[model samples]
Target: MLVPSCENDGGDSKIDIQYGAVINIQKSSSSDTYINLVALQNGGDINLGFTIDKAVGDITSMDVVGLYIKSDGTTIFKGKFSTGIKTFPYTLNINKQKIYDAFTQLNSSDDFETGDQLTISAELTLKDGTVLKLINDDGSNNFSSNIASSSTYKVFQAYNVSCPSELGGTYEFTTTNVKAPTGESAPGPLTGTVTFEDQGGGIYNISDASFGGWTGLYGSGNIARNVQLKDICNKISYFGVDQYDEVFTFSNLVVNGNKISFHWENDYGEYGDTTLKRTDGSNWPALTL
Candidate 1:
């Protein structure tokens, strides 16, 4: 359960959009445990928020209000008072064209991962100018589109991911002081000829770094960043921000001929945006996965 604080990480992010509906919990003859949630939807930003009182459970009552104002002051989609989906917790899914735009807004943030809770509420103006809340927790409810693939997205900038074939020569990698996110590039010159030896069975020697994971993943995260000469296997992929607790592995890189290339990144980022580095290309800071 995440406590609603006045800060995000170290940066304080707060809002006053306490409008919409509320989830009131009523057990068998028990006190009505009202769960107050606040959702601050930025007018013209790529981000939105859902704040709920508890990490779990559903709220039966409360009318959620929402507006579907378009570019020309026209309501593209309209809705009245509703209840949240109890099974899906705090998510309100309107099965209309506006659903596409809503997805774009939700996917703008980089915090889409498992265990991350998404609560949704809406408010509507009645004919009498009265505000009402709607939506309830149900299985058919969808807060946003499902995020498939654990593969991480890497952005490039200063140093881009390079392949051995890109070097077009036999290059060697030797690390003097290995580090994370930042460190001195190895084998003397930052730019030089690179070589890749494909040893079949999910194993490749990139300069001094080895990459492989099980089931197209070569191995696991433990074998990726460390100096090892083993063909480890892992069936997992993950995204990393600030720090990566999961392993990133490469696979099935065979050296049929010479001039083989290896793509790698020293990507380190946060929630808003993640940038990557490319090997001096048309785009300085590009996006890589």
Candidate 2:
């Protein structure tokens, strides 16, 4: 009789799962999430919006905070952006005046330099006196891997300080002393016209990276057309692969008024020194590196 009483019940066993709250980024004014230095200097605002998901929790209120992270990795607590916010969705209009005030409160003498970042996060208070937040006191994330990996569960947003790029136009490209793979002179000085088409956010689509040297060495059909240039806060660099899947390296970058000159080499042992001058009679903004 005791052994017969060990029969299973008809009801199914279940495990209940509860999820914590999350901050979902709804929209951003800048697609690249950058705070334009030129616009900030001209009295513009940093605009973004987010929504709080309750996620099976009883949330009473939330406090939004900001942290200013310098380029050297120093983190400064800029203090709360909003306290006791009971709203589900909120829009942030961060102006230069508010940023300046925060810096002043911290007694920091540093300006809002390029490459610095401003991160926004929040602290949520539940009905049972429980506080939940993504960031810790030491300016580090304290959340689960599942929440961190969720694209829709964005707990924080970082906006970088960037300079406005205006380096898109037609340029007269000149290449000299191009060398082949065997270290032999493949071509003499070659001159041509190239276009710097703006692709936004300091990126430009160059008409050609070889500056007619590839056409001189190979045929016109083998010219590098997929080459791209990046001007990050005046630092110039090359990226993107050529048709042969070879990467390009750049050096000796010098910017003089309306002219930009640099030395470039590819993985195939081909190299050249090139100079580019704007044909619109407009001087390029001061650049370095």
Candidate 3:
């Protein structure tokens, strides 16, 4: 269980509209326990909080408060509030079983594969029977439309994950095969040999990088800076500065054995998908620090 502090927004002097609600997800102290597939399966808990400001009357009872997934309009877990907050602050807890059930519904079947998303969000019903919706000016109780998008919904993909092993080696990869979007030509098929070094703990250092006839992805003593991961097959978390010092990040990558394909975008707003396959590393120079 987690306890998070919340602050209520100052309300107007109006009579009827006395309370306003805001929900927040608390950050876990331990990074490892921060909402993962394994933890949810083992009955992990989600910590949540809210604040009700300028109550005209004491909050005697709350009808309902819970964590929900907007995708299927399902409420996986409901929180319990033993006593109402006669004041301004309150917290809630969502059990792991709720989250696990939601994910299981998303998966639709027994097998967990890549691209299955866990879309988590919060919902609550006040004592006056008003259901909260996170919209600009939606006063309708029939909330057929105000759900949050999957990107901002604490999204995580389910994959057949395995530990990184024997993946270290030098390989030549070609970038010319990338199919550009409509009205754009390919990146002109540049080939370069890059190295992947296992740094343990699911982290891999990528270096000696180059793509599309450009160099410097790992330069300026920055060979170890571009750390990526064979994280949970089909899910790649990448962060680094290229040789030109332009920052880029990769996500939703598909890794099939020695091959990798990903959607990448840079700080300048340029983005594309690049696919790479392992080539014979026997003739490639050994990785240098």
Candidate that would win on TM-score: 2
Clashing pairs in model 3, backbone N/Cα/C closer than 3 A: 176-189, 216-243, 217-243
| lDDT score, candidate 1 | 0.26
lDDT string, candidate 2, 12-104, tens digits: 644444345566644354444456777666766554444444443567888887788876776565677778988777766665666666555
Q: Model 3 TM-score?
A: 0.34
Which ranges in model 1 have alpha carbons more than 4 Å from their true place? 2-58, 61-83, 86-221, 224-263, 267-289
For candidate 3, which ten residues in a row score worst on lDDT?
153-162
The candidate, 1 or 3, that scores higher on TM-score is: 3
lDDT of 1 by residue, 1-289 (tens): 1112243556766643332222322121221111111111222221222322222223343344333333232223333324432342343233223333444433322312122222334433333444443332221221211111112210100100111111212443221212333332222122222233443222234432322211112212323332212221211122221123333333223231222223333333110111112233323111122
Question: Would you estimate the TM-scores of all the predictions?
Answer: 0.23, 0.52, 0.34
Off by over 4 Å in 2: 1-33, 40-43, 48-160, 182-184, 243-245
Q: Which residue runs does candidate 3 get wrong by more than 4 Å? A: 1-21, 31-121, 124-130, 135-174, 178-182, 190-273, 276-289
Question: Which wins on lDDT, candidate 2 or candidate 3?
Answer: 2
Candidate order by TM-score, decreasing, is 2, 3, 1
Candidate number achieving the greatest lDDT relative to the actual structure? 2
lDDT of 3 by residue, 100-149 (tens): 44343433222323223222222444567655433212211212212112
